[model samples]
Target: MPAITHEAEPAKLRLAVIGSGNMARRFLKQLPDSRRCVLRAIGDRDPGQARVLADEVGHLCEGDLICGTEDEVLTSDEVDAVYIATVHTTHAQLAMRAIAAGKHVLCEKPLTVNHVEAMAVVDAAQHAGVRLVEAIMFRFHPQMAAVRELVRSGAVGEVRHIDAGFAFYVPSDPKAATIVTPDLIIPDAGGLEGRLFDPHLAGGGILDVGCYPVSMVRAVAGAAAGVDFLEPVSLTADGSLSGDGVDEWAIAQLTFGNGVTASVRTGVRMVDNNTVQIVGSRGTIELLDPWALSPSPRVVVRRVGHEPEERAFPAPGAYALQMDAFAESVDGPEPEQVSNADSLGNAATLDRWRAAIGVRYPFERDDAVIPTVSALPLRVPAAAPGGDRAGTGRIEGLDKPLSRIVMGCDHQPDLLTASALFDHYVSLGGNVFETAHFYLDGQAERQLGRWIAARGIRDDVVVIGKGGHAPDCTPEAVSRQLVESLERQGTDHLDIYLLHRDNEDIPAGEFVDVLNQHADAGLVRVFGGSNWSVRRVAEADAWARANGKRGFSMLSNYFGLAEPDDLPWPGCLDVCDAESMRWLTERQLPLFAWSARSRNFFERADPADLSDEVLVRCFYGPENFERKRRAEKLARDHGVSPSAIAMAYVLHQPFPTFALYGPKRLDESRAAFRAVEIDLSPEQVAWLRGDQS
Candidate 1:
């Protein structure tokens, strides 16, 4: 879609300011000079404050200005765009609501409290097709544009290093008191008792001011290299924390992939030089005040032998320019000053900085609360196909029907990311989640547990827990890890449990006995093995039958369209061979197939690229490549992606099969879900697998 363009005469962009704080006041003051936009409303939690601010700026509006609570302004049809000048923690939530209402948003920096929240908001905006930009006003300043031009013009000659700092001291007051809650922080006293000193509000110098220097470094370095932005390859940081656990001061050294390095320093408890200096092979450029650009905006350039040259850029205030850019974006593309990727990357860097200093907000560690875009809990979509159920298969000992495509939770790093994907999966009628005790050292289990708790859908969803991985593959380790995994998952029992890997040195009967005990105790409903051989599985089941214990009912080995020539991991097994397939068909045991799409083998177009070492080492062969080619041909015939064909091949097996799919993004999960809608005949599946091609 074309960007929104508001000319002087025909149409004016209508905007609403959604906070009554100092930042909101500053933005309101810029309306008299803004040409492309008109003030439509003023909103705040306090209606009196909103009315006061609205009256103060009423003359700038060409129409009747609405004044009410933030929620009212967000839902008002009079507002075309919203300026979110609220506290740091509320940025993501407010932006989400604005996007939900189909309003353009210019949110304050740092975009959200953390990278996870930032990603959620960005994804929401993109999905909604609405404009969303972080309110980093300085980027739209004319002085910064001149700096970028100077760097891009080669005046600096191969930029190699940068040093930037933004810091100031705010005196602590003894009389100030703050009430900290899970979602917000209320201050009894003004200024000193405000959000700046509260951990619940994500208060810190790094997020508040450090973002300026980090963003400047990225912008300047990218201009020198002719790109929009460059991410750092490595970052090392050190900082001090206050009594309330916010960063007092910090310094980080970032190394970029383009051989450029930078040092960024920020603080709220101390004062620093508050300048930016860029060093290149032949010269250096300096900014007296890069962020505020007060007094006079100037840049100083000094070469090896020439005298220092100073240039000045005078224009409208930074806030005015930022507002103009936001208006332009309503019908246009996002401003390059603070694009979606830039905002997400900046948030990620800030997250790393905080992680380095051992600074984590209380909400971040709370497992029972998942930060979501909407206020209501996520539930399965009511209008889904098949009336709230998709294709599913049942195992003998398990009561709940497991979705054909099981969600693998190891790839999600945080609760927000996990919940976003998990919510989408459930919306598509998927109910089973695959988790393991050793994934991320149990972090994945905790995150999944948090998602389940927050959504209050433990009964609606099925959990699969795997334990006793190699090196700890013992009956005793299985029992011990099961207890810990249950606690981490916040569940009394896992619906389906599996041994991650086999320990063939021990008797198969010993492992079966431990599993049966857990099943009897209700800690596990049904038990299986992940990478055990077919012979060992039969041996364990034989022993279970003899002892009148519950036998193994399922297997979770690698099964897909393209057979693997070698194992990716030490003890991982591929059960696509004829012997294993025949055994599974005869025994009628359900198989949970991991790497069902051959770990993205069918998605790779170039068979000769050989860039991915693991893919090359495990799945590279003439037969596998032939299978991939045939899958692509079948996909074209069916008008679907080659990956869809690969997935269909696994689901079309004679035995009950559930494909364990690990997707890192929402779109990937949606695409995986589409595989269930495809149908393939047994002849077509065999042909794609090279059985009769």
Candidate 2:
């Protein structure tokens, strides 16, 4: 650890307190009066309470204080440091916001509710070059520093085990009672009344008070090893819960990498004096009260066959020491006494402890654990998905039926949002999920994997995985990306795999052979090409037939009523012209068409308003305008949307075809489903295309 530089005399640092509850007031009372720090602002959810806090603290400090909302104080330039004493769940978010705005942060203990979010905040602070310190003030006490020094000096030689516990009983008061009802029970208040027992707000003895013992043990183990922190190899925890299903008392055991073991016990519903004992092979060191700011420091050092030596030290204010350290860290060569890495490690250990005790918050329950069999996911079930004749289609060499209207997942954000959309689609008899390797930075595939594992509905759906896109389109790239996509989706095989882009430079025969290799390994059920010309398909089939391998089973090209005047994106191929339709009709091959509605050119487009760049470059021209106009008249006559009419044009093509649909919400999905019910005769389709009068 690098030493923090201290100035001989420095100006006071401006501070903004983000919460006005009891903890905030306690911190304010303990702030040093040496003019090294000043309380400049108070921000809280309640303006009245914030103003009261501001008035009280303003006289104690050297600044004129004002009250404001969280946003005002966070974005204000007058604040040099932010002390976050908000609820447990809000610590990470507020700290990240302050770090982004170039302000130092002192977040209250249990730096975050969990490890995943804590890592995100720590990463953001490191990137922005800001100091992010956790306010576990007791660690900064002079008594603790003396104990660490004694342990480092080999006073307790070859430390083998540690026993530490912090416990206190919170009596039940009438004001903190739970409101009873027939179907639900609500808490009476927020601060100490309900927030301390609520799981959703991340309140519990484990997160609130047990964290002290956990961090202390970790530091003791590190001190024994001549480091600042040590990660435990395994952790086991058990707890007794309160009426609200949160832990009121808990005990945890951690084993370090160096074979040192430690036990930690904590509670808010029991009575015990907080103490720490470091037991070594030759001697032991004991601290009577270790986790309080006002406890008289009593230390006992005992060696085998020797009388114990008792020592006493003066008590100091922990919160004042913390505040003074934070003030010095504002222009740091290093941040305060606690490093960000130590905070991260502590949060991760607490997260594991919470998991072992089966304690979870509302926001962290989105993902369901996948069941393990020999450390592998279960095989996909064999039930065929529910489908209708008009909404489902079939391809050669594959047994599972696919939905005619495929679900495109290019912009899904997270598992929770994606799960809702997936549930709606399945309810509407949709079964296929179309995604690629690069969608949403590979999150789409990961979310789909978790959703399927959670619902156990893998056999009831068909997953379309695409790879080998553009510049790296080769046999090796295709194989590598297919395996990676399979791993991301948590499946052994893909129902349908398509090449996202075609490489004309590579021989068509080489593409077919590589695809056959995947099929032979049972990794791919059916393989096809996207954006490839009909001539290339024929050439690939000719080579496959000669070599006795599986040929391309489908063609997923752009086919819609409103033809593309020019390519909407570079290196994209559309087979919407007359010759491709004639070839498909003659061969009767399965056609899985993309952008089948002409990118919604008919629904949101008017011939009088062609101002959109995509509309002008892709689907706005004299012929497409005439086609959209005719589709509009047909849609009005048939009581459907113009987009549905365009969909009818693609579905009622010369051969077997399927249209891909991208719906952001449930209503949009329903509109797309309504289009599946509209059937158009060949004559009506030709009339809409302006082929006949």
Candidate 3:
């Protein structure tokens, strides 16, 4: 590791404490002793509490310390950074606000309530160029450093297994219990009543105390493998939830890619051994007090055929070390601190642990659509007028204009994340959402439906519903699934519908007849086929035209800049080849291209990295690499990402085209939306596909 050098008289980082709770008080107590940072302000929901905290640390400031509400402190120029010691539910919101205000942040762990929020927060911080660190103070402790060194030095050769636990009994008292309901879990309220038992506040033992053992396991495993962190390949958990649905106790077993295994236990209402043990082939290492180091932290190493060795290291308060490290990291991140990736991995593990035990917060439930942290609609520039039909296209038999890019609704993990993504997409003028019956076993349709109902934008948006998937690809199944899809979506009629897969075993006219029946009954407006070959579609349309019924007007197939070398899933079709493109162009049928960017083929810069099996199987070949090369060149010329260039290629086809984009992050959606602004000439499109025109 390289040494971090500082100037002889380094400037002290002006810091503000965002919450005036017990954690904030502890941080303030350590602020006075930190040489690299100084207390500048204290903020809380209650001004009186903020003033109390400010008074205790006011003497350490060179000037008058500001004490006010959290918003005032965030906007104040006196503070350069903020330490968010608020409750679990408020962490993501406050961190986002702080990042938006352009202030460095040291957020308490686990970074947010779940991985979805953590990804958003981390991405925002990176995009804003603001330093953000999860305050897992133990990472900055000297004892952890010693442990990492020992693991890396072969003291515990080839680490094989790890056992860790962090639990303590917190007896339930009637007097200390606040109203155990979702409606009353207030944010930033300094009280100990039902704070740790309320699901709305993201209260539970796994998130509060379980993170310690999980993070330790990751760090120790990373040291053994010579990396910053190693995420578990698979994990299974068992636990008990409180009456309010918060986890009271849990145990998770994890297996890493490098053959390292671990078992971690945590709880707030149960007592267990609070230590970490790393077992290796040659020896074992144990920490007496891993999370909160004792005055003299000890590391016991027991080697094969040798006496047990005991080592002690001087222990400065972990919070003090964390504060100093965060101050230094304003310029650049410290090597020993908990990194953003580390925090994301830890949050994902906790999410899985909670999920395995069926512990879900109220906000994540199906009935609720948690608003964004700001609780204000995002402000985005409207689509440019008269450019590519104002970044939208008209579909036959559909009243609403569909955005050139359609949002795919399969990857969202929960309602909160789905709502946020939908909200952002709408703010960017995107109205079309693509949902299938098989996605997440119908959860996707339910989430999209709930979001539409919550926003009351059912009339303003065009929904694309798909049914008749494989193993149930019959007219009877289509009729049954359409009714369920409508109910799940909370709508009376679908703007557009498609058969998820073709069934050659049955005549194409039978499927067309079923869809037309739904159309006659006011359950469907526009009907089409997904993954159906040209012959099947032509036959279906012929039958519909002869019988005086509605027929296929659009298609959902794998079409993108790069020609797919193979299909990623069974019964999928590709229409990017010359013959299929010509056929579609001749018919002038609208194509809703799925896997539109070749499933991130253009986004990944390295051609040698084959870690993604789908990408390799579908898009890894000489022809696709050449296409990717051209996309990069064009992307540089247009001052956009290769992904944007690929999306533009899809939209620039001779026939009407709309790209189905499934973005797991906000930035990715933004990038896909930008493709509509890019205009590619005919020659450029031809050249991009290696055609000499």
Shift of residue 188 alpha carbon in model 3, Å: 19
Superposing every Cα of model 2 onto the true structure, what RMSD results? 20.5
In candidate 3, what are the lDDT values of residues 1-693, reduced to their tens digit? 999997788888999889988888777777666878888888898889999877777787878889999999999998999999999989988998899899999999889998878877887788789999999888898989888888889887889999999876555763543322212222333355477888888888899989999999998888889887899999999888888888888999999888899999998776776889999999999998787676688889999999999998775688888888888888875445688878988998888889899998988776776776555554434545653336889998977678989999999987888987887787677889999899999999999998888777787889999999998999999999999999998899999999999999999999999999999999999989999988899999999999998889899899988888788899999887778888899999999999787788898846778798888887888888998899999999989899999999999998999999998877788789879989899999999998952
Query: Model 1 compared with the native: what TM-score?
Result: 0.86
Q: Candidate 1: which stretches are off by over 4 Å?
A: 1-10, 174-193, 294-296, 305-307, 366-375, 383-387, 391-393, 411-429, 472-477, 505-517, 538-550, 561-565, 578-589, 596-616, 619-655, 662-693
TM-scores, all models, native as reference: 0.86, 0.57, 0.86
Per-residue CA lDDT of model 2 for 261-308, tens digit only, reads 999988767566578999988899998767764546678999888899
lDDT of 1: 0.85
- Residues 1-693, candidate 1: write the lDDT tens digits: 999997657377789999988778878777787777788988898989989887777888887989998889999999998999888888887898899899999898899887777867887788789999998888989888888888899897899999999877665764645433222334543564456778988888998889999899988878888988888888999999989898988999999988999999988776787789999999999997787666478889998889999988888888888888888887888897789899888888888888888888877764537645555467574533654465887777776777888999889877766877787788677999999998989999998888888788888778999999989999999999999999998899999999999999999999999999999999999999999889999999999999998888899999998888887889999889999999999998889999887888888736668788889888888898898889889888878778878888889999989988898766666667768988899889888888794
**Candidate 3 — which pairs collide?**
none
Clashes of each: 4, 0, 0
Strongest candidate by lDDT: 3
lDDT scores of the candidates, listed in order: 0.85, 0.79, 0.86
Q: How much is the lDDT of residue 259 in candidate 1?
A: 92
Q: Candidate 1: deviation at residue 152, Å?
A: 3.2
Model 1: residue 196 alpha-carbon error in angstroms = 1.2
Candidate 3's C-alpha runs over 4 A off are 1-8, 174-193, 304-310, 333-336, 378-381, 385-391, 396-401, 427-429, 470-483, 502-525, 535-552, 565-570, 601-622, 625-645, 664-688
Q: Give the Å error, residue 677, model 2.
A: 51
